[model samples]
Target: MINFVKIILIFSLMASPCNSLELYGKFAQGGLITGKVDKKIDLYVDNKKIKISDKGYFVFGIPRDQTNEIVIVTKKNKKEIKKLIKKIQIRKFKIQRIDGLPKRKVSPTAEDMKKIRSEGKLISKAKNINSNLNYFFDSFIRPAKGITTGVYGSQRILNGKPRRPHYGIDIAAPKGTSVLSSNSGRVILSERNLFFTGGTVIIDHGHGLISIYSHLEKTFVKKNQLVKKGEIIATVGSTGRSTGPHLDFRLYCNNVPVDPDLVISLN
Candidate 1:
């Protein structure tokens, strides 16, 4: 009887829930995860350091092209705890091809490249600003009404040459069409012209989430302005290297670009 009791006690001790972590998310593509963790524990995903919030919570996002198993390790006081490895889900996306001519057009020259590089520096600065607010989850609306010409994660063969996969969804609308805010966010950038993007706008939705609107005819909102969902922020145009009047909408979570279609439903 004494030996049986000791064996039961040992089994119970081994089954304790402490030193364990639970992770889950709606979508696993692009190496993204949202979960909770111990405050004092050091966390590693596939041996990479991840950022953790002060409340002992953490969210790590991976890019679309990365495909590998994730390993999470937590440590404290030289003691280590590891969770069972989780395999990342591979996403299969569709391809789209667009052939069109533009009414108004401009080509990038050597001088234009210099100007674009300078403007890129400003856009990069705005996207890195961190705010302690949760304004992104408030309702999302379409920025403009038009036909979706291009989709996210689509491989592009532009003018008979292959290019990088399209990261933004293209909305083909008439020139001067009003572009509204998809959700409440602070305007991080409003540039009039870029070499590839033409006029561009970026909004920070807090918690490392950001939205970018590119190829605009006109910009109505200024930098650092707080905008509400459905607010008119810009006008559609065929600026930059585009072939027609349209809006290119892109979304990112913690520097990892995500499919906007996953976050919001389109009408």
Candidate 2:
């Protein structure tokens, strides 16, 4: 095993981990950072004001292609302190040519484009809700286990034509394989049918942290419902623009996509 994350801190507050401003977790491409500081201390990562839980915990995420270095600042008791975390860990994405996709999926006409735009708005609105609940501290679990087919940040070529880079991890499973919730959170959106993702479910696990599950045969939960970690929420299937039975899972922080592989352990 290799350590993909490299951490650099400007100063250490104390010998204890919980006393001063401390950042825990990996600092890499698609990495997540959870911080612990003194209560009532305001913290900002890259100038964005992030929420600090009641227990003095806050989390932030690094995007898959964040070229700029991360900057963290702390403001408390009329004093402002900042530190340069580190540069991003750039990844080499290979071109993945996926054939046998429907022509309409590859090249949608005006009518299909209309539907795509509408669904995109709905999805965006669902992910925009910044809830105050913090449930991500419990860790995440695999939604559906099988063979991994696609990875994050990979340039996808559908039918030999280049398309958007893949933003989620694709897992191949049986049509009826049960899909579990990656963490405990409230179901914000459970659209049964979408233009590209078929049945899509978006869970908000507090603050701006969210996970998306797409291409489902059926959704078991509804919007605004509370779900526990590892709860069965849907089943895998080849819906909407898919070539085979699989699930596309994605994780996001502050609405920006992050790599799910770095956030959780596969084994």
Candidate 3:
């Protein structure tokens, strides 16, 4: 009778529905996580389906300001396996306030309204271009040599009114300084004389990663051009509501703006 009971227990253990599921990564904000499971699993962050890939391997990234506990669930054979990710530390960032920006710089006059509308249309068109960007995991290089004038996440106080936080890092450089591609990507937008950004160029770095270079003295790359890392794409300039010659570099993941400094090593 004891032997019979042991045999039954071993069979039940072997027939259990738990798969080889593992969720491993740094549990910090703005960090990337790698997940593996035996079967294709539906991934969710705060109850939003982000993505699912074949072979049960998927990647998810935490935003810089996210603080909620992440929950991952996989269901097989009507049984659910749940995993809770905790103790995530959201990094604290510095906030800067600028008090001297002129009113005209923040608000355009009636004469410039038409240009603003035109620029908006161009930005809308560029945002619609879809690029299967997931191959941009290479190291990033500085696009130009200059002093770091502005930083990411700084709150803007335009004429005593709080504005949206600045999402890009600004480098102060001389006019006509050559701007290079930070990583390999396909140019998605190249437009000159925008209302606010001036000569702007946007590159899609596969898998929803994009880089925007603004206030260019001249644009060298065209739309749909594939550029390599460190290749010259534009020249820095002071155009379109800028105080002086500088480059405003912005990075985005899908539609969410992210800090460029978080992914790249400036040193």
C-alpha positional error of residue 173 in candidate 3 after TM-score superposition, expressed in Å: 1.7
In each prediction, how many residue pairs overlap at the backbone (N, C-alpha, C within less than 3 A)? 2, 0, 4
lDDT of 2 at 116: 97
Q: For model 3, what is the error of residue 66's alpha carbon versus the real structure, in angstroms, after optimal superposition?
A: 2.9
TM-score of 1: 0.75
Off by over 4 Å in 1: 1-24, 35-43, 53-58, 73-84, 99-107, 136-141, 265-267
lDDT of 1 at 81: 59
Q: Total backbone clashes of model 1?
A: 2
Off by over 4 Å in 3: 1-39, 52-65, 72-88, 99-102, 124-130
What is the alpha-carbon RMSD of candidate 2 to the true structure? Answer: 2.5
Tens digits of per-residue lDDT for model 1, 1-267: 011110101111123454345453433454335555555667787787655566555556666776776676666665665544666567776766544523222334677668877987886776666565455434356689999888778887665555688887899999999998888899988988877788999998776777899999999999889998789999999888788899999877666776665545422
lDDT of 2: 0.82
The best candidate by lDDT is: 2
lDDT of 1 at 99: 48
Compute the lDDT for candidate 1: 0.70
Q: Candidates' lDDT values, in order?
A: 0.70, 0.82, 0.69
Please, what are the lDDT tens digits per residue for candidate 2 over residues 1-267?
227443534245546444477666676677787767776777778888778888877778887778788887777664775454666767677678899999999999999999999999988887676778878655777789899999888899999999998888999999999999999999999988887999999999987889999999999999999999999999998998799999999988878787787777522
Task: List, residue by residue over 75-111, the lDDT tens digit for candidate 3.
Answer: 5464555544456666666666666555666877887
